[model samples]
Target: MRNIFTKLCVAATIGAAALVAAPAAHAVGVTAADTHPEQATFTTAPAGEVSIQAAGDGTPAGAIQWYKNHLGSTGWQGLCEKAAENSYGVTGVWASANAHWNGASPKHTTGTPPAGSFVYWNISAYGHVGIADGSGGFYATSVGGAIGHGSSVSYFNNYRGWTPAAVPHQ
Candidate 1:
């Protein structure tokens, strides 16, 4: 038993090192172009404008800001409005899927960023935001606010699979 544990520890160290050396890029089933129709005109919301809400108010700006604020604070600086244009196609899709949050898309319990995982991407029309709780069911916060805003960390996905995105900071 001790030997097995020792081997597992060594393997874990190597796995962690590999992840650090060659971080895995965020890849979902959907493509960036297919996800956001207005990807060309999208951008990150302003800092002061960003807010956390508990529902979708239709206004893109509010929801965008809320998501950015809640998605944790790591590698989420210098976020611009136009950043979502070509930067985060799937990011926008994920936000949209979450907006509905009706078990529409595909989601998994075994694969997710983690509870405090931070994902870097520009949500279409909304702008850049991070991942709060990465799991089968997670919740995101932004400035414009949305259906799941102001909630005590709701699951982003309800078993619906995750969409594709360029998650720079996974």
Candidate 2:
């Protein structure tokens, strides 16, 4: 009986140690913000004025990749990494989520969009990319060489029958 009791105690001790030694959730690539944080918020802009870089601009294949490469001088790889799965096609809810998720802040703005936030450009045929400022606006660079802060242009305006969907990444 004593030997059995000892074995049980040893097992309990090992279990406790393993729990303590384990790293945080983020260490395993699961973010606490995704679950603990409240529902995310997005800004409303007149769809016509927003200007995000489009996928047709001879850049990357996805909007998330574009944001990853051109969010800022430092670039937004970490945020891009976090938002990697959020990248869908050129115009979808995932793309919208990319624009809305401006880091942890409620407002990623052009002058100060979150490091990982997406910058959208408004254009025809395709859109553009920029750093998403949590605010209603973003800082975008256009293919025609127009670079500045502006609101996220809806994908609906890009084509004849493409109604833009709110991105799920948010």
> In order, what lDDT does every prediction score?
0.33, 0.33
TM-score of each: 0.22, 0.22
lDDT of 2 at 105: 32
CA lDDT, candidate 2, residue 43: 28
RMSD of 2: 17.5
Q: Give the per-residue lDDT of model 2 (tens digit) for 81-100.
A: 22322333323333322343
For candidate 2, report its TM-score: 0.22
Error of 1 at 62 (Å): 15
lDDT of 1 by residue, 1-170 (tens): 99999999999999976842311223232223322222111134467655444212233333343344434322222232212211222233334323422222233323554433233333343333333333322233232222122222222212233333323221
